[model samples]
Target: MNDIWLTTGETATLLGVSRQHVVDLCDRGELVCTKAGTHRRIRRSEVQRLFNPQLTREQEKSLWLHRALMGHLMLDPQKVLQMATENITRWKPKHRADGIAMRSLEQWEQVLSGGVDVVVDVLTGLDEVSSDLRQNSPFAGVLSDVERRQALRSFREHWDHEHTAA
Candidate 1:
């Protein structure tokens, strides 16, 4: 239990997938693994990487912006949600012919309609769906210009510190 390696079933539990799926991922070269005698062993880090794949600099920055919005959302859920609704209403017409953007916008509408818990989940999600939704985020203008600048500055400073420390 104190070992750094995990069994396939353990990895599956962490990834919210079946053990066979973890095996398939290892076989497909999606997740790295090694054999311990006849059993497969994966590093804890490998499982973490699969569950939370790394983000690009731009994606990290976007996450920071949303985090700023999330702060406001917590303080005033109705007002934050209203701004998102308005943004969706405005962007929907312009993106009517754009399949990807339209899908993201539609998903945003559902998330917003589902209320604050749903919104918070999607806002901080690091999954592919959340990443795609963020590409066409409807939370624009939820934060003031000064807030946006502050969030971005904070992100940059943190990013710099992390990289330098590493």
Candidate 2:
């Protein structure tokens, strides 16, 4: 009893196809339609179903992680770098501790800045960093290993399942 419906022309327009193509899809049962007098009517839900397939659990998690990481990077990358550098310096003090921490920070910044081709590598590195920080840094209680592992797992699963052209 979903009152929402779309005419064949509307369906075609939404799909970016010709009316004939929409009709063909209907004929092939790829898109379900019902006859309404002289014209065909497609349910709004049916059109949505055809256009937007359901994502798997891993895919959903990957999408969420990707968005969250990208949002954090875009919003305040400096803050992220500062926290990471502090953690690195505290965890491992050496002759060039600041330089070493800065190098890692620079690499993370480069990845966020689109210099790196593989996103999974960046995510994996972040996961490793988070794990190290959780174990050794004063911020250990603030960071969650479970969350980092989940994001890393999602990224790894997504990378394994999809063949990247890059």
Candidate 3:
């Protein structure tokens, strides 16, 4: 029986992962998927397919691209584009320099609602964070805790390279 698949966002939410994680898993042959307008659709049957664990051409490409991007970021820190994801400001403000200024949408409702260029820190629950702001933010998106942990390592690698090179 052919079962209808769920959307990437839905699967990502249900799986407690980022949309990018969902995409990556699908690309890596861990999850069989179909793409529709930048989103992915995962079938229930495909979940079982993941148990087989065989690499496909698509998976190879995905893996290669992943390695290439990581290598590029490591080798060429000068070309990397950085963006701010979250900003938390305490009651006492500190000297700021580089990027966007962010504060709680709760305490700093004015700053958040001012339509500034940076992401606003709105008071939100974890579930709300997965649903609402994740969809809207161009600069940030939700990732599975595992993915976040890995991404953090990847980021650290890049940052460390930049520091050493400088």
Candidate 4:
């Protein structure tokens, strides 16, 4: 119970889902969590039930820690997730997804709001001029924990190289 409240990644691994899935669960009121800005904090009691709803006296002694945890940690789920996502991709750019023009900010917003299904990111002229825009959106698909980091690393390096050359 003490350990479950340690970190979200730990909890998500215990729950067998992505960090984002955990966040979504929290957002939708599906899972119990306390939020501090972007970071989410969860307790064992919040996550324990999902692992095993049915209780036993033995489990109650350990307070529902998976017996496997007493042994080695589970195998890396990243490989399976990577292989699965090597096909069904998400957050792909609009221009890449469709041969559409991304010539302006309005066009990007239009694509996002006009029911053209893709994760929409808007970079505006606002210098802290804010709106009701939430960073996470309904259109944003399930981006697993593993894939998200790989994609970020891959793209950031590419972008950096391109900028350096120019």
Identify the leading candidate in terms of TM-score.
Answer: 1
What are the lDDT scores of the predictions, listed in order? Answer: 0.87, 0.58, 0.45, 0.43
Whole-model lDDT, candidate 1? 0.87
What is the per-residue lDDT of model 1 for residues 74-161, given as tens digits with 9 covering 90 to 100? 9999998998999888888887565888888888999999999999988888976786778788888888899889898999998898
Model 3 Cα lDDT, one tens digit per residue, 111-147: 2344332222221222223223322322222334665
Candidate 1 clash figure, as a count: 0
What is the number of backbone collisions in each predicted candidate, taken in the order shown?
0, 0, 2, 0
Kindly provide the TM-score of model 1 when superposed on the true structure, using C-alpha atoms.
0.77
* Candidate RMSDs in order: 3.7, 14.8, 16.4, 21.1
Candidate 3 lDDT score at position 95 = 28
Off by over 4 Å in 4: 1-4, 54-166
Candidate 4 global TM-score: 0.30
TM-score of each: 0.77, 0.35, 0.26, 0.30
- Report the lDDT tens digits of candidate 4 across residue range 84-133: 23323333353443432223323334434433122112221111111112
Evaluate residue 79 in candidate 2 and report its C-alpha lDDT on the 0 to 100 scale. Answer: 59
Error of 1 at 23 (Å): 7.0
User: For model 2, what is the C-alpha lDDT against the true structure?
Assistant: 0.58
Stretches > 4 Å off in candidate 1 = 1-7, 15-44
